[model samples]
Target: MSDDVYTGGCGCGAVRYQAEGRPVAQLHCQCTHCRMRSGTGHASYLVFAGTEAVTLTGAVRVWSLKGDSGTDKHHAFCPVCGIPLYVTFAASPGITAIHPGSMDAPERFAPGFVTYGLRGLDWDRLDAGLTVFDAGPTG
Candidate 1:
């Protein structure tokens, strides 16, 4: 496999995905939506600049919700195991965000910063060296 290629799937192995090239960003988010979806204090994500390089297989179910920016965010998950996979944004049609835990090599997740820092829980401490933002980073 090429070093630039990343592959992963759901818990039941029913849904799978492959993403090519380096991710645009890696981050940990403490937003209420992220925490609730992950069932944790935060959720890690690998953000890709475009979905053109991404290929998905198997059946997926999507749920749409209004994001903090008032844009629609569509979250895709496996219908079998109900594992959250990737997300698409109405405002940023070219971007895609994947759950780090769903990566075949989860260790590849190297978070560079934290988002929604103000919402972060005291018990869910993050790395002290990472830059944190009260909201999503702007390009």
Candidate 2:
């Protein structure tokens, strides 16, 4: 794992987090579940391996739901600011999706892929060179 550490928090500073090592994947998910989760056209996700790589200093209100793949999705967000933080997929304990917008250096996130491209809104232009998958690609 790369020794690139990222520290960030919610908008209200009520939820702080630290992620060590490089992210497994940086991608844009345009699936329906992501749209609803992010309250937008799509969601930006930075995936990391294992919860051990992430440290949280504040409490969060969790919301449990199922993704389009029928896998359990647990989202932790700041109750005070109502800003989404990360998501844990029950199907893959080793992987967690952290919101790049919550990062101290949001500019550091460079999406290498685009998932659920078929469902992506036409108006939301994405990088044409990125590796893309239709209806999903998890990893």
Candidate 3:
């Protein structure tokens, strides 16, 4: 794997993806949806800035829901093993965010911030040095 390339797949290897270039953002999200889906207090992600640099293979099932901001958030998972892989946002058409745990090299994930801080659980303490946001960051 190249330094600038990231490769990963579902637990069953039924779905796979390759993303080229550096990630735009890396975060740990504590939203209700993330917590429930991840079966944890938070879910970590690497957000690539453009979908054009990403390639996906194999079959996946997607489900969408309105986010807190009222934007449609589509989650893609492997239909065979039911492992969540990535997500696309209606508001950010070109962006793709993948779960760090799904990466072939999860050690590469370096979260820079925490989203939905208000929803974070005290027991699920994260690095205090990381910036925390009450909601998603906006330009």
TM-score of each: 0.95, 0.93, 0.96
**Clash pairs for candidate 2:** none
lDDT of 1 by residue, 35-127 (tens): 888888998889887758678989899999987656788999999999999988989899889998999999989999998888899999999
TM-score (C-alpha) between model 3 and the true structure: 0.96
| Segments of candidate 2 deviating more than 4 angstroms | 1-3
**Residue 47 shift from truth in candidate 3, angstroms:** 0.3
Worst 10 residues of 3 by lDDT: 130-139
Candidate 2 lDDT, tens digit per residue, 1-139? 2348988899999889999888989999988889877787789988999769889998999998878778888999999999999998888888878999999989889999988888898777888898878866553
- Candidate 3 deviant stretches above 4 angstroms: none
Q: Which residue pairs in candidate 1 collide?
A: none
Q: State in Å the error of residue 2, model 1.
A: 2.0
RMSD per candidate (Å) reads: 1.4, 2.2, 1.2
- Against the true structure, whose lDDT is highest? 3
Candidate 3 residue 132 Cα shift, in angstroms, is 0.4
Misplaced by over 4 Å in model 1 are none
